[model samples]
Target: MAIDDSLATGQRSLGDPAHDYPLWPPLTSGCPRTSTEDVSYPVEVDYAYDKADPAALFSPVRARGGLERWAPLLPPLPAPGLGEGATPLVEIEPGVYVKDESRNPTWSHKDRLNRCTTSAAVGVGAPGIAVASSGNHGASAAAYAARAGLPCVVFTGPDTPPAVDAFLNAYGAVVLPVPWEARWPLLRLVVERLGLHPVSNLTTTHTGHAYGPEGYKTVAYEIFQDVGVPSAVFVPTGYGELLFGVWKGFEELRRLGLADRVPRVFACESAASGALHRAFAEGAPAAHVTVGASEAYSIASPVSGYRGVLAVRASGGRALLVDDRQLADAQGELARAGLWTELSAAAGLAGLRSLGGQAPEDGPVVCVSTSSGFKDKGMGTHRTAPATPTWEEVERRLRAAGIAG
Candidate 1:
């Protein structure tokens, strides 16, 4: 397929017998139809690296900045940015690293996604952007929309954390609290009637925005640059956009003769409602599971997408599920290690623990921590009592607490 020599040419579907389409606005919903019933899976940008300069394509300039660092592989970013990428890769333990995405401008990994999706809104000349989110996605989208000087509307659930709602409102986004089932329909209306660009799932199986995950690919690029290809990468998966993006980034690196081996990717999900795990177990293309109550609401997806399956299967990885108890333990462990993350964000570490003995012998495993602990709904649930400022009382309390040797 002929493509633009500089940047991207078009998009290609991940459906059976993949098809291609031109690069343009409203391109995601218009990707080549895959099923007889008119269902469309996700589409990825196609870059003509063969025609372009490979040396300049993977130049040192990529080591700086956010999504712009890898602009050659991303869509046209007409929107302003907030320095969303370049997160730290800290070694939490021996042979294990944590990609701390909480350092992003919005204090979550969703900023990377919004950078591209909001740009699509600008590229299409849309007046505003909309998303169906209660947490990171909503906050990140609102920030990016504000950065781009565009209006934003968020279809949030009733149980959304007050802090998240506050941040969204602070960004000047229209926060609409609706029923879970009604969010998508309302988002559709916001997109169709008001001509707003949507950055969330519009399809049945989560064919997310065409340009959104392309921004996620920068995570993989950053990881590869920081410490080379890891032995494995454990990711907290909801719709699996980040999982697929990281895999695609490494895949691109290998295709470009940069890396010889791609890390074994793992889709770490909530056991209470692991749709991807269920799908993998049942040998189905995609599957739906009745979501149960869980603290990891951000990663509890009722319906999963084929993009996740593609990432795991393509990268010789597996899908693992962890319960709330495990997630809590992992959260504590991360905090002990000086990295506080949201309950859902600790799923990667929980999944990594689940593979204790069976972990790859190559070592150097990387786990992606998605968000900050402040976003946790159960945060500050514990109470602390203040003591009087007296040396006698202090010594007694310290002795009782075993701190006064």
Candidate 2:
């Protein structure tokens, strides 16, 4: 794949812009200046915005290539993509919308991140790519690495979702189901010894791949194009990469003089581990918490990232925590609205509903549905009993289900 003449200038520390590095050898580790400290900061890709043409960059005409369409604002994408991005903005209610990210090639928003992270692997000439994920991230990494024709090793928990397990194997990825605490260590060793690029977090506080979140920025761009600047964007956040990316994308639009204001970006997390919310409560840049049992497995992250704090604080947004009951209710609501989302993915809507009637009323609100319900754990375990074919049985079943005659 040809590299775009991307306007990406360099990488900078999120904590301090004084510490800058070249775009090559993307700092998989957190910012070197702060890594040894208690809280390490993540690095972000910088673009030469002064040189970018707002007209050409924000053109309404749909482009063919995947994230490459926003190449000017993105890091150089050297790897081939699997048609990620350009997800639908579904209007489930009058002034509310759902950015259904399941429409992506891999049926999750992680497709957007992996497309760029895998490209980083190719650009750096790494032998393969590695990730530590519960489900969606690993599946996405495998698909993109396969598309790039590179080997992939996914480090997952022992109880990997059946659907995601199938996805990993279908992509021919080497799946390693290790203890949750051991996956990151194994991933670091793979990167150091095997020369595989990592697409997931390595730091104690979750400073993920520099290029990964850049891919997520496209969600904001698409939202801007579809409905202008929304009043708020609620994101189902784990490490906060997606929340940060959405905030950065809108900030970029405002910087380029394309939009007047950026929206309040909400980070919605599972109450089982509301890392971001906890961090905010303690006035910390990042924090870690003991993860409890939660059916919303994807967003029940034990650690929160500094990137998420930056996004929420900068956008004047709030981090809301939703419990399993709230998650299930939101999931049921989405299903009723004709959108099937993972229990974790419904965190966004769950957060919105937690606000009662206090949701922002200035403009439209968007709850980003991060993945499909098919990716949920124990998805294939349900067995539907066969019903009798008799008219009496059918009518009785219909009546039991509250169906009218």
Candidate 3:
């Protein structure tokens, strides 16, 4: 149980049960990766990798109340749920399963990021929190900020999801509906002046702030516990944080000997943008392009991240671009599975289906469903019922609809 001798150096080791995870490459690269001025730029997060095994992450001596194993350098925040681990590893087929992240507190996996990002807000002593999102991340940040009693502000797009919008409002976040292009500058101004924390990725590149992915690593933790290691994981890629986080989690699990091997990290993106799709093939870190429109708006991004490339390469995975029609079909299949998720959420399922459903069974097939179907603001599915409600009238209606109760 000794620390990897090579990994040992000037680390403040807690032989009792704790350790810090570093974020930078070795200093011997002859590049002082971290400098205080980088606090202005912050190239390498002031963090380090730990010798702690993945299985020991929840041990009391190593954990904060046995929930989160504090990021060796990342800030602390509210731990959502009762450790938020043990989320349902639901079976979709004999071996395939969907990690229904929608069941999380805000009905999406963003809770994991929120838990970590909000912790950053607390750690940095931000007066408040802010984000440019009209979806799960916005609502999640608001709720987490409220839980932490930090003031929260959210810059939403005009087309922001109604369910998520209402959640932000309910949490009393200062919700500002701004145009998409205006978000980053506005966030910059706000952060410079008001000192509010920005949770979403400000970098046109998609590195999403440091702490958000820290929380998202929990998804991998849960998956490993459920099935040990899967043949592959299909993630609904948006900013690519969740994709990279899940990949990193699984990778860390393997490093810790908790899981046997790595799963194929599938980056499922909407065909509208295909940033990850193109970047992966080009063998580059990340790339930027113009975003085309699609029903999977959550993932319609022209830019991807460096971490995304690392995830795919490290796991021997592929980047998948799914069309809108295929996405619709995937949503239907999931509905049949009794999992009602949004079109973007179904993107992962679509990628799996495109794989011919012949995925191997190293453990379980996980499709990272990102959000609820209620997130589809353009959904006109809900309509007023027809007139009349008597037993005979309902019977006649059911007959016309080919339903019998």
Candidate 4:
């Protein structure tokens, strides 16, 4: 399928919109004018919203071919795709739904971001792609890079999940397991010395690729299409790209006069490293915290980004932190509801449950489940002992388990 031409005008700094730059060579280092030693800001793509036609862009009969359908509102998409968008919105309770993103090509929401980031790499005519990730991001980047026929280098922590490690190898990516703090620096070296395009964050505070989150905005568009504008959206936030993207998508709807208002967006983070939460509490644009032990490895981010702060603040929402216990409980709840998600992906539901009686009463609320349970650490380590083949033993075991035949 032929990808549609992008209507993206240019790029603008999230910290200072007055400082604009060309669409090519995305400001990966962020706005040089507004970024500082303490905190760094990310850049966002500017689309020709006034020129967009609601009837054509939001047509119910639009063919489904991933992010390409929304090309006019997205950055240049030169790279090929694996059908990344069009996830399902499953209702788990009355007026409460879960945006199941694990159905994507890589079984994670990062597929949406990588599809755009990889396209940026292709658009810029870079040699290859490099990234620093814990699991999902690396796997998604590797898949996209391979699809684009570009060499990929993945810098991951020594504790990288087995499933993700296998994914990197399967995609023919050069995998380097280093110390947690060394990933970003190594990624920078790969970009500078090797001339490979970086699809991950390279800054001190996490201003990821300019085109990455633009891919994520499709999540909101799909949600809006499935079930009008939700009252609120809870997202599993690490660097806050997904949260900001979802909020921006809805904001665009309202801006285009399609929707009356934008939903309140919430950031759900692991309490072990509540960088966004601390940033909000301290009234800072971004902040860094010493990360503690947490089972929700995917969302246990140590730093907050300006994009997330902007999304929450502009939407009049708050950043909420959930402990590992709450995350596990949420995971169990989802599994019982027939949706097995990564522990970190459950943070959205965990955050909402944290609200208890204070949950939103206006309209339907959505909790975005970012990845599948298969992406979790130590996913297949446990081995269940085989039961005895004898009928007596099976009957006894079944009876003990309340499954008598």
Candidate 5:
């Protein structure tokens, strides 16, 4: 098949693609969150999705405030609406703000990761993109692949939600529902044999794509621009890419003289799988542990990332373990604040609440809410008693639920 010329490539290129998406100048510093080794590299930029010729996310106008100001015209972001970045840093409570990332293209922070990583595929001339995820990551991958006009293949656990399945199908993705155990091998086969760019964490370890985190850095950029540096950032923990990306983004800003100090980042995870926590506590680079204590199952990974550990240590950050009860409370609290987020998404808020007011009170604090309640689907759907009532009865129920009659 004569694939489209806009595919991402295997080699790291400073070269432009069929469409020249803007990019920052070459990185001059080592990993912002790690002194151990390289985080990842040769990330690509897919087609820019901004409705205008240059989106404000990557525009010098916006960058003047963030590190993007340092590399004005740094590759323009392909942020095509649906609230890609620059999410409102709302101060729902005194001294605390939510950098609600549930507003992204796929309704989660994963969109940022794919935006940068999938661009790598187009930059290197890869024909398609592949991901192994049961949730937000797969949806985000499909969205980006569709935007770039490249084929997308998703390998996810069979338990993947119906909404997620429908989304992939709607986006023209080749969805392959497989057993969780087989995801890794399948991802490798697809990328190696099919020449597809992978936006997944492979290696049955912390080995992740360099490009994915590039997109994620935009969160830190937005936070710095909107709220300045907080004492800490609490990230919903998973493969640790998001945690590291936020840390790196701030560190880069400081390096470029964009900001003053890096925040003490926190990886908020469900107590079920405390791989990252266990690793940090064990004084090991990484660790593997099985867990089953929370519905924040989206982040229940057995593997701990050496890079994740490095991030926590370098930033003087901490990892906090949360439970399902705490996550449910956080989700409820967010609803009260008019932000409906998924269990995994609310995990950050849960971690913060768990920490009480112990976090430094001087600077602005932001919690990245990663996904939406719809992504969880389980919460949005209910088998409640049928509302098959007369009009008056229905009105009574509506009023009871606080809906205006």
Candidate 6:
């Protein structure tokens, strides 16, 4: 059950019986692969840990960086630090806090993921890293790869946000905007032919990079450190790496005797897909849902991974779905509270709101806002007035708008 690789015990597949694999090279081709199949599935990393002495981890030296504070439990890989972790937990209401992940180096939660996945590339001796994303993921991967001095390639859909395009270019990543269906095949080729480390999903059912979610575990650790375990955590879910990682982190804490119990983790997804929601409703092993239009494209994953389902079921959590209307309302609420989150990032808040009177009656609630507003696909779609008016006219306009009434 345990294969030693530093403090990391090993990895295992999500299937029944949980097939184990050695820790090195990440078992990236998938765990327990048979000659009869060629598809790769998700696997989880197992850590060997003693009861946690929180003081040992909370020292001044370790307070700054992200997951590096828990290096013993993670893969032994060199970090290309871009200040990806250690984001703020700001309380916007009486009993709810927003874990603002946009404060990361790349202005999104994907920075946490890339830091781990890119380190995996370094650990595995890969020349570069490749992923299929035009949003936060690609930009973050490019940034981390640049920091690591590795070539980066991003396969995105053609209608990528200009800000994201600029971000990828700034980090010197080669971007290929092709058909949506073509991205995975191209990414697989990048992994197979060029030996680049693939960080995103390239499988049938969305088994994401094993190390990527390790970065997300730090979110839970940081939350526990700041506010203790909340009653529940609402996370914007795509492939569910962040959801699973946060749950796993809490699991580690409980295993290490740091917390009394793990919090209920909520998977907040766009109603357009709601893959995890469908899976849970159907009691299926994995998510399979029809894709539809959604403004929160970042988390509207057509295929949901078992990791998310496992996180929800294991943590006694629920999967909540929100439409674009609810997403916009949540975004407005966050903006009013001085957190300008992307539509996708607001899914967590929307999910929390959807709870209505059914919300748990004990403990604080934490909603993870994943990225900045600028990452929204309609970033600059608003109109502005020309500045040809005099001060008097401006004041008149302000009065007319009721700003200076």
Candidate 1, 1-405: lDDT as tens digits: 012222888778777535887777646452457732333477888877676555775665545456766677777777778888999999987788899999999999999988888878887889898899979999999999998899999999999988888888999999999989999999999889998899888877768888888888888888887888999999999989999999999998898888898999999999988988988998865777899999899999988888899999999999999999999999999999999899999999999999892346685889999999989986666587888899998998999999997
Identify the superior model by TM-score, candidate 3 or candidate 4.
4
Q: Which candidate number maximizes TM-score?
A: 2
Q: Write the per-residue lDDT of candidate 5 for residues 1-405, one digit (tens) a residue.
A: 112322222222221223232333211121222323422222233332222222333334452222223122123333222235656677878878888877776788887767655656776767988888888988888887888888999998877878878888888999999988899898888877988888786654575665566667778877876767788998999878888778877876676555778999999988999889998888876677887755676888878665577678889989899888999999998999999888889988889999883446577678889988887747536877887669887888889999955
Full candidate order by lDDT, most accurate first:
4, 2, 1, 6, 5, 3
* Stretches of model 3 off by over 4 angstroms after superposition: 1-75, 78-85, 361-363, 379-381, 390-405
RMSD of each: 2.7, 1.2, 6.5, 1.5, 7.6, 3.0
Candidate 2 Cα misplacement greater than 4 A, ranges: 357-359
Distance from true location, Cα of 124 in model 1, Å:
0.7
Candidate 5: stretches off by over 4 Å: 1-83, 357-359, 377-380, 383-405
Task: Judging by lDDT, tell me the better candidate of 2 and 4.
Answer: 4
Residue 191 alpha-carbon offset, candidate 6, angstroms: 1.2
Write the number of the candidate with greater TM-score, choosing between 3 and 6.
6
- How does each model score on lDDT? 0.85, 0.90, 0.70, 0.91, 0.70, 0.83
* Number of the top lDDT candidate: 4
User: Where does candidate 6 stray beyond 4 Å?
Assistant: 1-6, 33-41, 51-53, 58-62, 357-360
Q: Would you estimate the TM-scores of all the predictions?
A: 0.94, 0.98, 0.82, 0.97, 0.79, 0.93
Worst 10 residues of 3 by lDDT: 35-44
Instruction: Order the numbered candidates by TM-score, best leading.
Output: 2, 4, 1, 6, 3, 5
Candidate 1 backbone clash number: 0
Worst 10 residues of 4 by lDDT: 1-10
Model 2 scores a TM of 0.98
**Model 3, position 68: C-alpha lDDT score:** 51
On lDDT, the stronger of 5 and 6 is 6
